[model samples]
Target: MNKKLQFLVLGVVLILAILFFSVKWAFRPASKSVEKEKADFTMEASALAGEFEIDEQKANVMYLDKVIQVKGIIDNISDEKTVISVTLKDPESLSGVICSFDKSSLTITQLTPGEKITVKGICTGYLLDVVLSKCALVE
Candidate 1:
């Protein structure tokens, strides 16, 4: 009611408002990624193995024409970049349904052989080597 009491109440209200807004802004959700069309690249363990063992050029051509999403393990890795050239294979270790990626995309420091993972990429028909689309770590 008096000037002093009114000022005290106003200060408290302002502090509360500031605190509420700060906390709200701090906890807001981050922007979402653009949802893409559902395209699938899949193979049976046996079939993938068969494709790989046949031959290098023959194997590469089958998978290189379209977008491929392969599930396999990190077999061989390069030292220069945290990049792993991945393969989709079966029990036999023949089919080289290949995929690849850089290290920054990984939440882990390094990926090694036998660490099973899934990858999504566009299979760019070979140019001396298999070129892949946006290669993402699929776990």
Candidate 2:
């Protein structure tokens, strides 16, 4: 093959290889459930929120993207189409921890405000409230 044709063929091959691997990684199966994975930190929801409120940078360094198991009373539960967001907080506190669960994995009908529950999830970060994503109820 001429040098120009050889270079073109090599570039096409590289592009195809890149696209193949990208698609494979994008559609890979989900990771293990938070319920099955061991939590890196376990604490009350109020305490987790307090940590973030006191020092957001420090809390982010310690808890961001880490698996945490938090126990607290359900302050509110909102069921969306794909996710069910459960807010856990002390009644008197303005800040709280929000745990989001996959709607298909949890049955929120039995859960109600004021009921205490434990949840395990990955801490995304803190906004006004500490956010936990990919959460699962800890029985």
Candidate 3:
């Protein structure tokens, strides 16, 4: 009778231990160690803008949701406290690559208008400008 009681208690403790470890493992947060993928396409900021201007649908098919590396002179940068937004040069200065840097890559400072730079980001599509998000500076 004592052996039977000990067996029952051991079984219950084993089940509870399994449940606790499984719950802990399942609820663990995802890791942030994964690096961003390499750029899928590379082009000048003005050229990217021009493609969208020529055919919005075709450009969307070619570049939307794809990582792109763009090079050009700076046209503007948003004056907000965070400063995540940047615009590259265009002929009209009205249409260009508009990049929004991710929070993880927000170490930029001392950018001035007309400074040449290269940036990589995921293209999200175009409105007045070709919009890129999750951007990071490329040396």
**Could you tally the backbone clashes for each prediction?**
4, 0, 0
Predictions in order: lDDT: 0.56, 0.92, 0.82
Find the candidate with the highest TM-score and give its number.
2
TM-score for all models, in order of appearance: 0.47, 0.79, 0.70
* True-vs-predicted CA distance for residue 42, candidate 1, Å: 1.9
Ranking of predictions according to TM-score: 2, 3, 1
Which residue pairs collide, candidate 2? Answer: none
Candidate 3 lDDT over residue span 65-137, tens digit each: 8989999988888855644788997657558998887555665575777899888888999999999887778
What's the CA error at residue 29 for candidate 2, in Å?
2.2
* Local error of candidate 1 at residue 68 (angstroms): 1.5
Ranking by lDDT: 2, 3, 1
Kindly list the per-residue Cα lDDT of model 1 for residues 1-139, writing each as its tens digit.
6999999999999999999999999998742211142335664433544554456468676765555655665555544355555554444554444555554454345456777666666666543334454566655
lDDT of 2: 0.92
- For candidate 2, lDDT tens digit of each residue in 1-139? 6999999999999999999999999999886357788999999999999999999999999999999999999999998988999999999787999999997768889699999999999999999899999998995
lDDT of 2 at 121: 95
